[model samples]
Target: MARNIAFGRIQEDMNKTSFFKILADEDLSSESMRLIPNEFWRSSECKILPPKVTLKVAWGSSWPVNLSPFMGCYLMERKGWEEFLNDNHLGDNEFLTFTNEGNNCITVDIFQKNCVEILKPLNTSSSNVKNEEMSCVDPVIAESNKRKVDSNVYGASSSSSSAATFSLTIKKSHLTLLSIPVTFAKEHMPKVRTKFVIHDPKGKPWEVVYVPSNGSKLFSSGWRFLANGYGLAVGDLCTFRLVRPKEMVLEVLHDSP
Candidate 1:
């Protein structure tokens, strides 16, 4: 599968400025949007890459994606990548270009299906933006709304919010599904399998289901979304603070790899 891959040279050919990737279904299901060419992996410089990298669009938008070595290739993690894909509505078979801008930053140029021509997504007045609107939210507006939520709700937290904060050191299992201390859950969580909103530090809301099983409490389904967004790893610390009857705020402190 590695041989005859659909990607450009990493650091040698074409002046070593850029590489291209045609998206695939496995990338979506596995939460690895982009893979570095094998040439990059074999390069001496690849040994010193940072744990994270910044992905930039021509527009004034950027995402911080975690970089990990996988299956002899480097892959962009779920944190910044999935959000970028969802926000931009990028689909399978879409073409992408990664241009190294130095200092762990890569400028991404997106191409429409079956074409090498780049699309000017930031040109809102252009037809391209109109067409994109038919599939997903405008990337610019979605990002603005995200910031709005952060500013608005974050400032609204009161002393009452701190009254209910709880902290836990993350374990390997927490990456799969977070477990709430039994004592805290029994005292606060609804007895039934109920849906409640969880606000990340950015104030983005995740509606997670709280399940009680044999005196244990677990956050399921939606919790993974939040975990992935923040790139939670084992040994990280998480603190959750109840802000309202149906809402709580979460803070994640990642451990050094």
Candidate 2:
């Protein structure tokens, strides 16, 4: 069987933009959609406009649409763009990432929250505890020691290690399948596709796949089962610890209504 590469990147020639917020009234409705204000097209280095392109959603779906530079902003033309919005149920205040795939093909990823919420220290001492019994014994001391160990082993730049720990605020869609940011995954995970284990707060283990998102990959599998098994919901706060290259530990900081 062909190895299923988890994620891939768009061609370098494609024009890409940072994640941008969707205007409440303008982006979701039938009104014409405007590209986020940026030098993406305005920069002297980027002047060519592709007449036609495809829009691929990370979740799964693609649409062919026309592109036109209008009044210093790029506008998406054709009814297909509207249909894409409706199909995705995109609304105001959400976030979308756009990547032009050359040949008029653009890929998009939707984010329920405009920004990924940083994980705060649930408790300073027990913050890095990997064992339950030890954490319960002396959380303060355990946390202090963990910090020292992390400092010695992983150093100050947390990004340098294969392991990572962070928190995310759950969204409605996350209830079905949590979305891991490409930036986070790229930093802590192996480049190739693989299945990893997630240990919930209760110390139960579940298997999830780590798919890299170069440009085409969307939410693959493994996370939803974990979320549903734990009955996760929107507004909940989830803490994740990438314990090893293929193992993670999860904890629910707060459950949602």
Candidate 3:
């Protein structure tokens, strides 16, 4: 069944502004935050905000076990909720807390008006799912689909879209490879080299090398990828891919092993 992600509700007045785009604040908006329509929360926009509780750091696994502080926050939609609770509740500072009792912390931020939602089971569950997805190849494909690949290899006012096709190829039981196209310069250009670093779901690192080349080798040296896209960098993760293949081909493959 298709799932409908409802963001909750937004005041009618704020709903008309197109300035609101739901995304991680760090990636898209330099501004810490901006007001969003309550409907944005109802339509999957809720994820854009910080969780009410989060684990900043932790250690050990047992009793007296070294654990980080647990952080917490109280959320409010508007002045009314604050009046009811008798606290200065504004969706202003992105609040975060630490606890001596546990290995996690809490963060609280409001999503919309009149609603005080806690990101408990939902936050934990989603983090688990994201971790699992990151470990596998799924996230990479999703990233590629969502982000356009462009590079400034050529001296143009704008970057051109990569024309090469990308696909997953697995050889050994534990190895994965990503095939992508690379374009070469028309005139006698100096051979160059670049590198691509793939990151796993846990933010682990994997690196691959690509070398620039010309002639038949350029076409044959499809850049090899060692892992699926899930473990690789996405649109906002890193700035560029660097590699130079032995043969001059306008393509690079990311290989996983």
Work out the TM-score per prediction.
0.39, 0.36, 0.19
Better of 2 and 3 by lDDT: 2
The superposed Cα distance between candidate 3 and the true structure at residue 223, in angstroms, equals: 9.3
lDDT of 3 at 111: 27
Clashes of 3: 57
Which candidate leads the pack in lDDT? 1
Across 27-141, the per-residue lDDT of candidate 3 in tens digits comes to: 2222223222333233222344433222211111011112111232222223322221122222332222212111122112222232322222212222122111111122222
Collision pairs in model 2:
6-212, 7-212, 7-213, 8-214, 8-215, 9-214, 53-104, 54-104, 54-105, 125-143
User: Which whole-number lDDT from 0 to 100 does residue 146 have in model 1?
Assistant: 28
Off by over 4 Å in 1: 1-162
Write candidate 1's Cα lDDT for 75-163 as tens digits. 88776677667656777577777766555666566756755323234233332221111112233323322231221343343224224
Candidate 2, lDDT over the whole model: 0.50
Q: Estimate the TM-score for candidate 3.
A: 0.19
Clashes of each: 0, 10, 57
lDDT of each: 0.60, 0.50, 0.25
Between the candidate structures 1 and 2, which one is better when assessed by lDDT?
Answer: 1
Candidate 2, 1-257: lDDT as tens digits:
00011111222223343334343564354334555344544322435766655665432235666766666766677466665665555565555556543344444645444342112222335222222222111222222223322322222233233336767898887776567766766555656666776765433567676676576333358777887887777778876765444556677756634
